[model samples]
Target: MDKRLFKEWESCVKCGICRSVCPVFKEEKSEPYVARGHITLLSELIKGNIDFSEKEAKDYLYKCLLCTTCVESCPNDSHTDTIVEIARHEVIKKHGLPTYKKILSKLLKSRQAMDFAFKSASTFSPIFAKKNNKPRDGIKLRIEVAGKDRLLPPIAKQTFLDKYGNDKKSRVVLFPGCLINYTYTEIGDAFVNILKKLKIDFSVPKKQLCCGAPIYFAGNFEDARYLAEKNIELFLSLNAEHIVVLEPTCASMIKLDYPKLFMYFEDKKWEEKARRVAEKIIDPIKFLFDQTDVLRRLKKLPIRTTYHDPCHLKRALKVKDEPREFLKAISDYTEMKEADRCCGNGGTFSIDYRETSLKIASRKVKNILDTKSEYLATSCSACIMQLADILNLKDHKEIKVYHLLELIDKALEA
Candidate 1:
């Protein structure tokens, strides 16, 4: 058990303020699904008051979407996500990972293997991939895998790294994470175009792999640390002034979780290096916002849009205003109800608990409908995946979803 996290757990007052903000609790209305319930269970297990079993642990721990709303709502400001992650780590340490997690972890460990897998998936994906009638931004590929509908942006024929080799003269390094590299190349393309327009020297580091967020969230902190070390070395080798990421989750992981991963490292040099790397980490949206001349050049778009605040982007990184301010400047922006609310696509949370994930997502979709906006702009790719699916699932074709970068690219073109 993490001592710091145990202390943090002890501070929880069980005020149920977390219950009001928790998306899962709102949908499930069950104690186990809420932060207080899980914290109580964790406290019991830690104190030897309750027996820990794989089945019992998985039931409570995996239920969280890790949106951090509970933590934000709590008066004690307990690190619910961290506590839950530790609980997950303990559970996995005792009994080992399930079969799917083993396969996913292996894929995250290698870029070549992941590329090969996606290449294979791409070959067969076209057989089932269908174009959406009301495509908004990005190539909407609607497909059904095992009878479950998934709305994904078409995978790039070649990745951003494949197309844009490392430029030694570039000061900025663009970290196109797995989602942007494999599934949403348009987002990557837009980011690059925006950089080009800004005349900001940048490179896409080919050696960099997934931010290891998938593995970390899976409770495989051991492998997550290894992946983080690999990325840190790659960035250190570049000596780039800034590391820009489009996906908020990847940015949050590198900026927040990467250092946490390094805490276990005994070597002071590596820990110092991790901190250095964290300093250079930047969100493209925030970076672009800082470039005043770039904003002045963008033509105001006439499109009406609503913004979905990605939980990690808003709650974790506290990047609430930049995207909205940028959107408001570029387009006629309207605020959606509970814009910072979780879209219920907490990486594997959606995959593992599909019914609960969709239940939460339905409310999110309804909120989007309430906005009556033609476009839905957000900072996180995970949110994009969930928003796209729920919109398609409900057959609500009036609005199309976009990454904020895509919108910036549009404004730049305009």
Candidate 2:
């Protein structure tokens, strides 16, 4: 019964503008799937017209991509996405998490457990996930656990943090996040290379954990808060001048959502600490863009590349131009149609609802193909993973997906 969530539920005028922009509605064409429709149902529940525990209500809640595109278009700035998250928290309070999700949450909380599991997964994943015939990026899996056609990048034998230890403290700290640490070490490798090439002072914090985006996004608010508290304390201890996050979602979660999490609890001390930490948090692309030392070294990469804006970077952080600034400086930049449109990754949404996620991603993939580019670049690792999967499924072996840092690292190599 959050007042802010209640306000958002009542604020929606049912304008249907959100309906037109919703990717899920485009695929499902159902009343429960669209933002306005979702708010409408939520409002009905608040008014006692519908039950919150109803399967229909729960299905509608989880079905969202959580892109916040609706917020971008909403005249009221209603924040339907925030309301949806709050509603999810409500649902979790009543039903508790499924057994698998509970186990996964525990894994996220432990460093040693995650390291062991991923180490095991790295060695055994190939046996489980078959390689694609046209594999350029990640290996595709037809296995039931991987869903119908999920393309998971091969796990790194040695993680970035494991390879590059925090020998001594530096002015800058890079937060590689979960996806980059385990699945997409290429981005992590590129990040280190770019920093080295630019002669930037940085260290990767070995103790830094997941930014708890997955937990919070999954409606495990308390667990998400636990993660945030741990990360905040560890970051404060490092006392770096800049904490450049590799994943856009991690960046936004730390910069924006971290403060909100504390404010709701009326924890003045933690909220202040979060704001201080937020000041130092920057996306790696933005960090590089601000570095004149790096700017002077940009080489015009002779490759045609198109940029896909991660929803977190574009909508949450308002960081649409920072990454593009790098692309414009280094590569033959092509603007894809609706470049800021959500690729339908929605964190684990792509895993849970594969067919719907893929259908939504088709629109984005078509937009990328329309650009006729050699490579697809984005700020978020999850976005890169999602785009790579959809492209692999379509048999587009020619195009490659890269993080902005990876592309920047390429320029430095050239």
Which window of ten consecutive residues has the lowest lDDT sum in model 1? 138-147
Question: What lDDT score goes with residue 388 in model 2?
Answer: 81
What tens-digit string does per-residue lDDT give for candidate 1 at 250-363? 998999877766654355676688889999988888888875366777789989999999988888878888888888889989998988889889998887888888888888
The positional error of residue 266 in candidate 2, measured at the CA in angstroms, is: 3.3
Superposed model 1: Cα runs more than 4 Å off:
47-49, 133-147, 167-169, 264-269
> What TM-score should be assigned to candidate 2?
0.94
- TM, every model: 0.94, 0.94
Error of 2 at 162 (Å): 0.8
Q: Tell me how many clashing residue pairs each candidate has.
A: 0, 0
How does candidate 1 score on lDDT? 0.82
Candidate 1 steric clashes:
0
Candidate RMSDs in Å, in order, are 2.2, 2.1
Superposed by TM-score, candidate 2 places the C-alpha of residue 5 at a distance from the truth, in angstroms, of: 5.5
